[model samples]
Target: MGQQGRSRTNGQGGPGAVDGFFEYARERQLIKLRRDAGESPPFTGDPVLRAYRFCNVFREDDRTTAWFRQNVRDVLRESPTEVTLATITFRWFNRIEVGEQILDILLEDGWNAKRIRSRLRNVQPLVTGAYMVKTPPGMSKLEGIIWCMKHINRRSLPQMPMTSLELAHQWLTQYPYLGDFMAYEVITDLRHTFQLQDATDIMTWANPGPGAARGCEWITGHKYNRHSKTDRVAMMNVMRELLRLANSDEAFLWPEDWPRWEMREVEHTLCEYDKYMRAVNGQSLKRRFDASHQGEERT
Candidate 1:
């Protein structure tokens, strides 16, 4: 059956039908609210006032729900399709009503079916909870990207100015289980979104010793000693470039609309990093043991 027919038969129907149901439900709720207040519905065309009414009807006394409904529209407004897809993927999928609103707005704003399809690919993978309960095959790539982005945390690395290349190399070196693909994705995001440059500068800055003072201060908080003039100058140059890239208006931030997903991805990334570090330390111990045994045999 065609989508419209299938949707109708399955009770999913058209957007208009769904919208009508919500409108009716909202009207009934407002009627009850007005009756309780001993007055008719207050008339107001102000966008904020209308938003407040919608929040009151749909969210009731739930602070989180109200906050989401209030700010979600702003988050979606004028945001790129990729960003919007990411946001939706991060938010719990049970909130289909919100998703519909976003889709409707996008459609109204002249977004084509192809654009929607592209977005769906980027958004689908990041979905968790009930939304991801029984995902179908042939889902779009946008969905997968969203899925990964939602789950991947690029910030578990020490709050230092390590470039993406450095972070990936360190992660792979320390954790044998962290494959090239995973490291690449994490590192790329750190570079493009988090403004990390590359590995060499990161390693130089992170050098830990009594004489090590030249590095990104945001992470190391140590100024380059003047005595090491060359090192100090190089560190300063790298730091300046890092700051320039990160401080730009185009730099990415976890959107306020995606608090849940942002937290989940970050937490997961940190856990993985910690696990990798422990595994590396275990390998080091094994190597030491092997070396000692070989030395004894030689003696």
Candidate 2:
């Protein structure tokens, strides 16, 4: 979406919303910190955070992601192809039930797309709203997904490249129906896996997803072009700069133990913060996870 494409929803959508990034970020982490420490219902004093949902500042800390790591990551560590296969397939749906079903098949039956299709066909909510899944004509979303999963080679595969998000994206987009945004999602998750531990790029470079892009627009006060490589780099620079400031500035109040933000953390936080700003303004952002709710949030 371009500058004209995204409008501030209400009175709160002015300079204040844009500038509240750090404070909002700090409060969010503190909210989770207190909640995890077993503090009561109100994890945050901020009304928007208390009532609505936002993902953790870090993706791995999100429940669905933790499930992925526990179930799929360790299981597939020895098999590079399996990591790629499972990560890509699980992320396509981004649903714990679906991921659980996939894990069962991958570890037991070994890539049974037919069973996956059958099980998901009658399921009320087949996939999470996290990623867009647009199937080709005449194919259900499951059918398109099964077709892609089948094409995943179980044999030795190409060398896993730990280069940049741009390159990983190029390779991942080769999967059927995995477009720019969705492929970017896969790439982010992969960075957390044992397979991509050497992935140096993700630490400093991240593909600015839509929410993050819009968030960057607010921060930079510049119209963002989601597809423009130049625009992505500009956003990357801004996020890195924020990470630097958040860690260095004592005036920037945050949890004492709040780990310094990486580029991906910065990216993830910006995206959620955008939804937060909009939600507080009375516009509905995609509701996912919260202190009381268990869910896989959206784009």
Please list the residue runs of candidate 2 whose C-alpha ends up more than 4 Å from where it truly belongs after superposition.
1-19, 108-110, 249-256, 286-291, 294-299
Q: Relative to the unseen true structure, what is the C-alpha lDDT of residue 235 in candidate 2, on a scale of 0 to 100?
A: 81
**TM agreement with the true structure for every prediction:** 0.19, 0.84
Q: Highest lDDT, which number?
A: 2
Error of 1 at 40 (Å): 16
lDDT of each: 0.32, 0.69
lDDT digits (tens) for residues 1-299 of candidate 2: 11222243323335544437766776677766787888887766666776678777777777888888788767776666667777777776778877765678756554677788776787657777766776667877788778777766666334556656668777777756778777777777666666566676766777677888888766766767878878877887888877776666564544456676667778878887778767766786556345575323642
User: Compared with the true structure, what per-residue lDDT tens digits does model 1 show for residues 1-299?
Assistant: 12342233222223342222223223424433454566633422222222222212222223333333344433443433332333323243324443553455333432333554545544443332221322224644344333433343334334433443545445532433233333433343333222343345432322121111211221233444534757556544543443333233443322223222221122222222222222322322122222111111100
- List candidate 1 segments past 4 Å from native: 1-27, 35-66, 93-132, 135-299
TM-score of candidate 2 to 2 decimals: 0.84
Clashing pairs in 2: none
